[model samples]
Target: MSGDVTLLLQAWRSGDAGARDRLAALVLPELRLLAGRQFRGERAGHTLQPTALVNEAWLRLSGLERIDWQDRAHFVHVAARLMRGILVDHARRRDAAKRDGGQRITLTGLDVPAPEDGLDVMALDAALARLEQLDPDKARVVELRYFGGLGIDETAEALGCSPATVKRHWQAARAWLYDALSPG
Candidate 1:
């Protein structure tokens, strides 16, 4: 952890609410960038804009003030959590829309390269739940690397592993998730 991060964490721990706001300000730009990268290769016709996703994530993240904010690694982990929450919330809305007999809400454009042609959010969430049960570390790695749009190097740094290890875990986790989430 850098001196600035240590100082901020101390302030946050001391209950200086303003420090939490500063932390959000410092981190929001990077969060926005990561959100953009997460959607970079999406099919152009997909409806959800990257900016909207990031803004939604920002709103959700801003509500988390009780976090320990241990260091950069901790920040990435929390950001991944925030991103997952945003996606899940969006998924829930899509679910509601479908129940109301509106147009089908499709996230199939996310391009998860499972044997399956596309992934509905519900299936994806279920797969993640199974992954969490099987191997929490691998699941977190998947969330941070894929959903958080972090590179292998960044993931390695966050998870305290070698880049090669990060690659292996990513591949295995993706394959497992693909199988688990695959439509029967």
Candidate 2:
């Protein structure tokens, strides 16, 4: 099944419209599952539905013309990354609106424990950006495992590293993020 998805992705990369549609059909369910996992940790009353999130990510993905699709894991990783960007952008806009008397916004997930109350998405995103600068491999391990909802072996495959290495990075990254996000 993954081989088929990979082939379709490669075909899509080559600009085959039929392959794009077929690939969407093949991957939509998995994409929805990923989006659903992301939303499960979101604040109650958050406006975006899982399907909507999947659609938004799909739309953004459709616009990209340069990605070298390696396999199903790679494709899903890209989709997850796009969804993260969309959620982060939404959070920033919500924060901006709140400054003008709009409702406060909260974002959850990324497996960070609630800090006193809950995790702030914007702060996490900022800290992640800094982590990316400091140690890109560790940051990617966090992103793939936490945000992408990928398992240890899957993450190892995606990163082309040993599972032990991924586990080490995952543990270290979680600790670093926890400390960085902790109240000062």
Candidate 3:
């Protein structure tokens, strides 16, 4: 199944319109699941729905023309990154309007105990940006694992690194994120 998705992605990149449609059909459910995870701990009456998130991510992905389209994991990782950007942008817009003081999302599945009030999306994005500057590899590990919802091996595959290395990065990144996000 992964191979099929990868082929569809590659074909889509090669200018096959049918391949794009097939790829969308193949990956929509997984994308929805990924989006659903991010929204799991959000407050009631949030403006975005999982389906809407998936559609937005899909739209942004469709406009991308330069990606290499390596594999299913790689494709999903890119989509996940885009979803994070969308969420952060949404949070920033809401924050500017002083709507509920911005959107807060849980770090529940990132091997860290999320604060009871959840972490603000904009804050997390800023922390991640700082981490990116400090150590890009570690930041990628966190983005792929947390935002991409990738497992250890899948993250390794996406990063073209060893599972052990992915594990190390994940541990180190989580610690850094914990410190960066903790209230002093």
Tens digit per residue, CA lDDT, model 2, 86-170 = 7777767777877632222233433455643346667777888999999999988877876677889989988899999999998
Q: Candidate 3 — what's its lDDT?
A: 0.86
Instruction: Give TM per candidate.
Output: 0.78, 0.89, 0.93
RMSD of each: 3.8, 2.6, 1.6
Kindly indicate the candidate among 1 and 2 with the higher TM-score.
2
At residue 100, candidate 2 shows an lDDT of: 38
lDDT-best of 1 and 2: 2
- Residue 32, candidate 3: Cα error in Å is 0.6
Candidate 1 residue pairs in backbone clash:
none
Off by over 4 Å in 3: 111-115
Winner on TM-score between 1 and 3 is: 3
Each prediction's Cα lDDT score? 0.68, 0.78, 0.86
lDDT of 1 by residue, 6-54 (tens): 5776687778878767876776677778777766645455456667877
From the highest TM-score down, the ranking of the candidates is 3, 2, 1
Candidate 2: stretches off by over 4 Å: 100-117
* Candidate 1 regions with alpha-carbon error over 4 angstroms: 1-6, 43-48, 100-111, 114-118
For residue 173, model 3's alpha carbon misses the true position, in angstroms, by 0.6
Model 1 root mean square deviation, Cα atoms: 3.8
lDDT at residue 179 of model 2 (Cα atoms) = 83
